[model samples]
Target: MLLADGIHAVITDRHGGISAEPYTSRNLGGAVGDDFDAVLRNRHDTAVELGVDPARVVMMRQVHGRDVRFVTEPFGDDPPPLDAIYTTEPGLALNVLVADCAPVLLADPVARVVGAAHSGRPGTQLGVVPALVEAMATRGAEPYQMVALIGPAACGLCYEVPAEMREDVARVVPEAWATTRQGTPAVDIRAAIEAQLHKANITDIRHDARCTIETPDLFSYRRDSRTGRFGGFIWLDGG
Candidate 1:
């Protein structure tokens, strides 16, 4: 998807690649129990399909914190534990892997800045998406001029949580408070993220409404404990 004049974003699903059963095919996450080589292959293939160099794709360790980094190159074999990364360099695609967590892509074409963030329950509470916006602002990207794409994740109706847990998250993010379809407590991570983006003054927001837990084509840790992770990739068109 073209996010702006020269910025592009892509969200991957479970179909297409070679990771085997549990982590079957197109699993871009290396930390998962999938074969190392298979995960590497999947990453390479996904980058190629996106017209980006595999060597240039920057993947995060994603500790589900609010740590944001301004990266000029890939993190190599040992990526730091971070939830968000922004870059001013063109063609260096920032990758965020997730099963049920929200993968957020942000870009300001005029500033030539792009960022990707991993926002799960903890990350949302920590305000990772807002942190990413701040990191990108350091490179001249303004919140009002930026566009955001939120990828597939567990929806409120399917993301049931303990009553105490929901109340705790809602204390920090009221928009996260929700009730599941079965009338149980739930936390709407995506809705909370959207609210966060709006609070940051990013009005141009798009979303892939597919719920990971309800969508079979996408990996969902809540639905299947042992599952592969898909990726949300964002990059500039030229180097």
Candidate 2:
């Protein structure tokens, strides 16, 4: 959907490609033990479906850190170990692959800057989204003018975590602290991200509330350890 004028965003599910079981169809991640050829094909198909040039799509080798990169073209064979990426060039789509981590898409239509980030428990506590906002600002984007989309991820009720882990993350982002339906410690990564965005002065935020762990149509590492990954894509119109 359109996040703003000229900015397009999409969150894909685990369907429509040509992979086998486990990574069964529409798996866009390349490092999840899926066939490399199938992954390439799935990537191509996803870009085609989005009306974008597959060769221009960029993917990251996410490391659950706050590192961000500015890109103008595809990363090719070896993508860097970064959690966020942005581009000022139109048609150069930025892709974030995730099974349970929140996929974040951001755009400042007035400045023509677009960014995508993989914000999991670690990345969220590390302030990856805030780092992304800072990076985009260097390219003439401002948080007040940016629109953000938090894609499907493991919700708090479904993302039970160890008490210490929850406490650690909550220390960094208190909004992440939560209690699951079963009354166990949990971290609401997406909620934490929203809070971060709000703190950055970004008010036009949107969300795909489907919890990956609860939604069968979506990929979830917490649900199935050996699972495929869906994608969240964002790009500007016109090449």
In candidate 1, which residue ranges exceed 4 Å CA deviation?
Answer: none
Q: Quote model 1's TM-score.
A: 0.99
For each of the candidates, give the backbone clash count. Answer: 0, 0
| Candidate 2: tens digits of C-alpha lDDT, residues 86-199 | 999999999999999999999999999999999999999999999999999999998999999999999999899999999999999999999999999999998999999999
Judged by whole-model lDDT over C-alpha atoms, candidate 1 comes out at 0.94
Q: How well does candidate 1 score on lDDT at residue 112?
A: 90
The parts of candidate 2 lying over 4 Å away from their true place are none
* TM-score of each prediction: 0.99, 0.99
Q: State each model's C-alpha RMSD to the native.
A: 0.7, 0.6
Query: Candidate 1 on 1-239: residue-level lDDT in tens?
Result: 89889998999999999989998888988877899999999999889999999999998888989999999999999999999999988899999999999999999988999999999999999999999999899899999999999999999999999999999999999999999999999999999999999999999999999999999999999999998999999999888
